[model samples]
Target: MYLDDPNRKLLEIDTDTRQGPVIFRWLTLGMEYLIGVILVALIVSVSCNVVGRALFNNSLPWADELARMLFVWLVFIGAAAAFSRYEHIAVDALVRRLPLRIAHMLYLLQHLIITGLMVVMIWGGYQVLSRSSGRSAIMDVPLSFISLSLVLCVIFIAVVSIWRMWVSLNVIRHPEREH
Candidate 1:
């Protein structure tokens, strides 16, 4: 069934390569593992809170706060991973229908817009991280730690987007080699 689809090859090409510096590759892998750990921690915290509430008539207050922080980390890190993988949700019907050159141009434009947004996010996150003095009630962890996730996620995303944009430019220059 997959063999019959003309667009299957394009999809495969889109996802085929890992494009980035060696450091970026290692960092991405490390983030992936961290994401896994955060998810597991979230699950365990929530489970313990629920079980404790059900059986012992009391819940761990810190558990809820920990789960919330873990979830935020999970989402931001997962978003970075998805951006690196080109796995983010996109409405690409127009790009898919356009001629190859136009599509490539649009793809590059999209990357530029995303990169700009990431830069803005990084700046804003940094401001928040530096200015905020609040701490979590239960754990006493600085709220800046949570905001740092945003800064880190955007930094990762911006780097990956820049790398992909370079690859896109190369594809435009040598369209024949793309396949």
Candidate 2:
């Protein structure tokens, strides 16, 4: 089923203040591409490692550990990328049945809760990164560097959430073209 709504609310908030949407779009796209590349690399590396272990009786020592770390990054980065598109799962069945104005308010309240959650995530992730900066038990890479995904991902989510809020408030206009 499809809804007839134009869904400008999200885009409107993102496009507010001219420079806002541009920067947010760039950041979202950048992170999406970064996550895509990392995910593809992880898949290839894992496959090669498994094949080598089975066929050649030899395995890349770093591959397994690196792939695990990348999996963590993949989840967070993909989540952030998805957030920009308003693709995260939501239970709109009940809300959708309400009157338009009531539904919109319900949606607004829901997003506000989500915005708060994202803020907490960003703040908590930063603390985690700071404490793990010098800690690395696997692969000698700084744990903080790998953990930086938490910070990057949460920041992107927060930005998009705030932008969506602005759009709802009519403080920004939707871009004429779809992203």
Candidate 3:
């Protein structure tokens, strides 16, 4: 299940400094900053590589590799940010059709399931990170560093999902109050 209103702003989670949790406010800000930096870096690296190849007849091999690594970070980190904001793709038609109380129950269930999946992913990522020893050909960065992104992403998602579930429960308990 997803949030009911598709027209609502995707990143409109309770990030207000005055009314929202301080930790979540900082987390959202940090993730936004990081994603912006990663996007700019990805763009610059790809552009430089393309220009070098076209104009100089030589390419920066490291540029391709760096771009790839940056892309990995971008996707995972972006997913975490999206998760925090409940912006991921989801089909909420059935939930939206149900009574508000039942719909919120479904939302709580969905969040718990997501939290479970993220926990499993974090565990699997840890396993892979421990076993991975290879380095990127150009950057010489350990493979574990790349695998760590999965762990980081899931950690953040798990936190957000759990928080959402808590909020959903509160809403369920106090249907008259706006959460």
Candidate 4:
């Protein structure tokens, strides 16, 4: 459902339009909330570390370690959430100039690339997770904990890419059947 604007540029698909099955919508919302929570934790950890050093001339090593871990999770989860919302960068100027069918083909190709990369990342993450037997120096948390974030988010991204490919295929097959 596109909102018509007389002055608007042609072929600008509204990415803000959230359309997906209930589970995906839930996952997107949950990931967004997770990102917010992680950000707050990251801020708090860094702030405490700063205050400890500035006010007491002592810094907690755990705070720094926690902050780093939170930052890693934030980045990976944020990426997945952004991908869910179609918030990633794209060269839409060129795609907009093409026929709708051709554009769908391009979208399909893009998603296919993403899916392939995600698969590779998933395998790599698994390898790292399996191989790493070490723990954080200060926190004593398993190093695999950090690598799991990559595996989880990449899995989500891959699923979203597959979903996008399916949508593009449908559009290419039955343009008139689009809602």
TM-score of each: 0.85, 0.78, 0.87, 0.89
Task: Estimate candidate 4's alpha-carbon lDDT, on a 0 to 1 scale.
Answer: 0.80
Candidate 2 lDDT over 1-179, as tens digits, reads 67523443334323224434777767767777888899899999899999999999999888988898889898888887677766677665676576544555555665688779888887888888777757455588888878788888877777676666655544223334333
Which portions of model 4 miss their true places by more than 4 Å? Answer: 1-18
Q: Per-residue CA lDDT of candidate 4, range 1-179, in tens?
A: 64332111222223345557556778888988899899999999999999999999999899999999999999999998888766677556777667767778888898899999999999999999999999999999999999999999999999878877877787789767743
Model 4 Cα RMSD, 1 decimal: 4.0
Best model number under lDDT: 4
Which window of 10 residues has the lowest lDDT sum in candidate 1? 4-13
Candidate 3: RMSD over Cα atoms?
Answer: 3.4
Q: Which 10 residues in a row give candidate 4 its minimum summed lDDT?
A: 4-13
Off by over 4 Å in 2: 1-20, 171-179
> TM-score order of candidates, best first?
4, 3, 1, 2
Model 3 regions lying over 4 Å from their true place: 1-12, 16-20
Q: Candidate 2's C-alpha lDDT?
A: 0.70
Q: Which sections of candidate 1 miss by over 4 Å?
A: 1-21, 177-179
Q: Once model 4 is optimally superposed onto the true structure by TM-score, how far is the C-alpha of residue 29 displaced, in angstroms? A: 0.5
- Judged by lDDT against the true structure, how good is candidate 3? 0.79
